[model samples]
Target: MKLSPRMQFLVRNGLKGFLWLTVLLAAYFLFREVVITHKPDAWVERFYARPMIIYLIYCFSEFFFGLIPPELFMIWAINKGDTWHYLFNLSLFAGISYLMGYINFLIGGFFYKNETFTNLKRRLLKDSASQVKKYGIFLIIVAALTPLPWSGVSLLVGSAGYPSKRFLKYALFRLLRFAVYGYIVYQTHQI
Candidate 1:
């Protein structure tokens, strides 16, 4: 039997999802070069002197569709400053990254609105709306902490028009997640 339109769309989206995952993995391998070379000091000298631009770029990267290696450039920034400055820089990076999560959320929401996706949600997310309303904040925090790809969640929130106040609160928690993970990485790597 021939696949229906919905089935075809699902197949296409599944392929797209696989492609996206491959791209993310390949990007990480590409970044391994920079990590291996270890140009931390040079970057420190460059960005530490001009943090504003760096921060803006960081935010822009996270806001757009950029894969974060968590430390491609952040390590340099951290070591370039005083301890507090390091923390501040890390926090700034996290804040921008968390905001970018909203971009992801929007994308997911858009996909959710698609004819195929809408049908999928109607069938799968039978209680998603009510559950979202009740425990959205908790879910956001969990997604943020775990490497569950939060941008999609953010996109869903954006598309659903989830309350802005709650979104922001959830976003702050997401930002804090960066700090938490970064500190762990920094300590473990001693970088």
Candidate 2:
């Protein structure tokens, strides 16, 4: 009558999944009812229609600073409805994110040249580069897939002088993260 350890873990996870599914269904029904009773405003349509504005905001937010959470944009894409438009927006966001990571990689090289910090924290500087060389790529993918600061990971890889071609090849894993997140957000919100 007792479950094995693996079975226990599976049962616990199944229960969690059931709970989440129930909540999501309830939310979906509520969302449908609200949409039926109250239409979205005209400005809402206008804003979503303008892809350029959204792309600009995404680029600036991602590149200059990781200021805005990308989920907001994903949700926006879901609300936009047309499949092509949503896909376009999501792809644009992912591309910009990748480019920003590359830029951060280059910016990291600057730390090596900055004599002020090097003088103050020689050991710290040397150790960081060594650590990156040792474990940067795996850590980079993990950071990209999660909510962690992927920009910092990119910088570390660059600082370690990891080859640009290798970084590009491996860092494409970020696209997978985008695809998975986009699917979940879109599915949950879609009618």
- TM-score leader: 2
Candidate 1 Cα errors over 4 Å, as ranges:
1-57, 102-135, 189-191
The local distance difference test score of each candidate is 0.63, 0.71
TM-score of each: 0.55, 0.69
Residue pairs in clash, model 2: none
**Top candidate when judged by lDDT against the true structure:** 2
Candidate 2 is scored at a TM of 0.69
Tell me the lDDT of candidate 2.
0.71
Off by over 4 Å in 2: 1-50, 113-123
- Backbone clash count for every predicted candidate, in the order shown: 6, 0
In candidate 1, position 140 carries an lDDT of 68
